[model samples]
Target chain A: MAEAAESPGDPVTASSRPLFAGLSDISISQDIPVEGEITIPMRSRIREFDSSTLNESVQNTVMRDLKAVGKKFMHVLYPRKSNTLLRDWDLWGPLILCVTLALMLQRGSVDSEKDGGPQFAEVFVIVWFGAVTITLNSKLLGGNISFFQSLCVLGYCILPLTVAMLVCRLVLLAEPGPINFMVRLFVVIVMFAWSIVASTAFLADSQPPNRKALAVYPVFLFYFVISWMILTFTP
Target chain B: MAAVDDLQFEEFGDVAASLAANPDATMVSIEDPGETPKHQPGPPRGSGREEDDELLGNDDSDKTELLAGQKKSSPFWTFEYYQTFFDVDTYQVFDRIKGSLLPIPGKNFVRLYVRSNPDLYGPFWICATLVFAIAISGNLSNFLIHLGQKTYHYVPEFRKVSIAATVIYAYAWLVPLALWGFLMWRNSKVMNIVSYSFLEIVCVYGYSLFIYIPTAILWIIPQKAVRWILVMIALGVSGSVLAMTFWPAVREDNRRVALATIVTIVLLHMLLSVGCLAYFFDAPEMDHLPTTTVAPNQTAKSS
Candidate 1:
């Protein structure tokens, strides 16, 4: 049964690892590999021992990727095809999404001026922490993906949440009644589910069949929290 | 039926006694599902009855037996029944309260803190107690002023006072409940996740109301300027706590929504604080005027 469960051909059953066992294994394996070879090569001039300037080729690639991300922002909603694109670490998409989320959070408040710094910092930290935590969990569960790659996938997965946030903002403009709430509620739920499914789809490949649920649980929580924040946005 | 009523009364009396014995014992351990609650600080507190029922297999018995047992056991509406909600440790409650008050970023500490410690009882009771205190003190102050006047003035209407207190207390939980429901609905709609339970939201809201306890206590001062200062402090502490707690939760791609949520929460907190001050603390003075005018007439008639 375990062998059948672990079989690569059985995608449906492969990731359904026993919850307690997987959790125990992850906790016990404290020395799990967290880093891999940097896939995106630096194309810039060496500026310092730690910091290097971006080379023209690398800069061009990033610019091109940013353009692609912009052109394919909608791909984040239906990210099955975008999985191939997410394989290359395009930090701009995540960065833009993070900024957008932060700005969305700052809307209509009296203390927006004073709150801007902390709000942005809070959003950035949460996103990075969530990505890192999910990455660590995946790695501990024998995930094959690199940390940066996982971060990219996780970051792009927030697009549905972004959409949900936008819809919530629009919905809040209307009178707050059951009908308006229902509409906001419906949009957020759909987007939140999309985000979870999308993240799981992209990230779940590396986990063993039994540990898959364990891996997806955090992702679900991450997106659900974001969706909830957006949904409860009462202006 | 008579036997069952006797049992019910006896159980109720025991629960009341236990509660009176340990008024501060808010923690209830639910570590063992099947076994009766053993770590309850005071007396056994009715879980023994549950264990007995389980042992008798009365849980799965025939309808008549179940009905008789339930009647004999008392309806599941007692304080002990709700004690399960206060499952988190007292130390953890303090930790969460601290975290919610000073929510530094990086790990989304408030969110994680809340997720880990999902207790509703401590906060619920604390808020209820604060509101109740404010209500009682307001009524007491009014009653005292009326006594000082020595006029057969209209006493503070018990019905109105009780209803007002109940409404204010209900608002403490009701608003949070509504927001929780909205958030859950949104979570289900958007992420298809029910991340925080209703109790967890209640827990957060309850802890957030900690500032109001002091404010409620200060309401009895009868000085408007001093009372306003206390109200401001209450609003500041509670508002900041809420902002810190909810910042990470509401932070999203849409700045408007996040700002709106924070503002709404703060405004709601302010509204409740101000409303408590306006209705419970300050209104007794206005209510005294009508009574003072009526008191002279009543005294004259009596004389």
Candidate 2:
């Protein structure tokens, strides 16, 4: 019976039998020998810097990389499990989001002390610090993802929050009243929760099951503090 | 060699097919069946090897499950099919009133208590009683004014006063109901704060009117200065109660939202008090009273 189960042309019976039911549907059966050396194709590797590669024009290389970064940004916004886009770490999205958020925060308070506005350096430092802190926590908790990849995910996750901040800035344009307060409150709350969920989805893989909840708490607190700041931002 | 290759391929296919049939089967374990045990024979350590293997081996299934779970849990505000807005014991109303009158932290007890035991019964009755009291007092003051003038004012219009009082009182409740609706809509979006239900809003607004009852009673006091002093005192008391009750819920995270809520509550309270004072207490000037003789023999005298 076992020998019949192993027969090449008897796949239907083999698949129907419990003994051969452990296989993934995607894997195809083909007769192949295991004695000889088997070669597995490697995924495309990121090119390393070399003198030969340096011969390529800087502008052309930068343009090509930028295109790749744009694709990665789109992937982050509408994530696809099939794509390994997070592997292509890029700083452009993070940088843009950080600056935009800071500007949105500062726009409402333009009339205050001219220097009181959120300085770009200050905003960048805060964003960097938060990302690094979360990355370090994740790493210490058994996250095996690369530091840059985690940072990229963390940064991209701020997109919803950035949109929230923009909404708050617009809300400030309305007369400060109960209705206005309600709108601002609603935006911040939703964005804050979104940020936490999005970050956890990308970064919580390395955490043990027992520690996952504990690890997610800091991410929740981080987004909450940001949300609070955005909600309270009055021009 | 080719025949051996074909045989090996068939074995591989059999394993794959078996895996497809029973995805949870232990046959997928990467531990080599023929190899001797290594290390402590415990769960895999975080040396990155196991994770990499898992990622490479089961990327599709893992991601599909994760995405499915995420999509399933993403809807934050599910429709509440049945909601009980009012549910509080009669005795708790006194507790709520006492709590509302306490200091900032003490007021949080009222908020927490109200949150747990929300009800409109106490607040509704309290507001209704105050409105009725105000209407009755306004009629009493009009009767006194007529006696002082030695001419009975055209049988004091109880209907007009009652209608006005009812409209104003209804507004006192309506505004809060509207505010509750707005808060509910807002809560649906962000869902950070535990939202107070419609009944809770009414209860808070009702308890806040505890001070207004005294102001309504004092309306019959003929002295304008004394009435104004009493009105101010009433405002102070009710405003403090509102601040105490609402502060804890609003203060911690969003200062702007807190400010807006406080302003709305205070404004609504003041509008009710002012409307009561203006409509019920501010009797029409004697000069505007069209002098007419009820009796042909009686002479109309100017005061």
Q: List runs of model 2 lying over 4 Å from the truth.
A: A1-235, B1-90, B100-106, B112-115, B188-191, B252-254, B285-288, B292-303
Candidate RMSDs in Å, in order, are 23.6, 27.1
- The two-chain DockQ for each candidate, comma-separated, is 0.01, 0.01
- Among incorrect, acceptable, medium and high, the docking class of model 1 is incorrect
Taking the true A–B contacts (Cα pairs closer than 8 Å), what share appears in each candidate?
0.00, 0.00
For candidate 2, write residues A1-235 as lDDT tens digits.
3333336555664567564452332123432332111312211122343423477889878788778767765655554462354566788888888888877766433433332334455556767886886676556444467788888888887888898988888778889666997998998888787777667767667565544654565576556546655765666
Proportion of true contacts reproduced by candidate 1: 0.00
User: What value does DockQ give for candidate 1?
Assistant: 0.01
Model 1: lDDT of residue A58:
81
Give a tens-digit lDDT track for model 1, residues B152-253: 233323233345547655766787787777666566545421234455566767777776766676677656777788889778766776666556555542
Worst 10 residues of 2 chain B by lDDT: B33-42
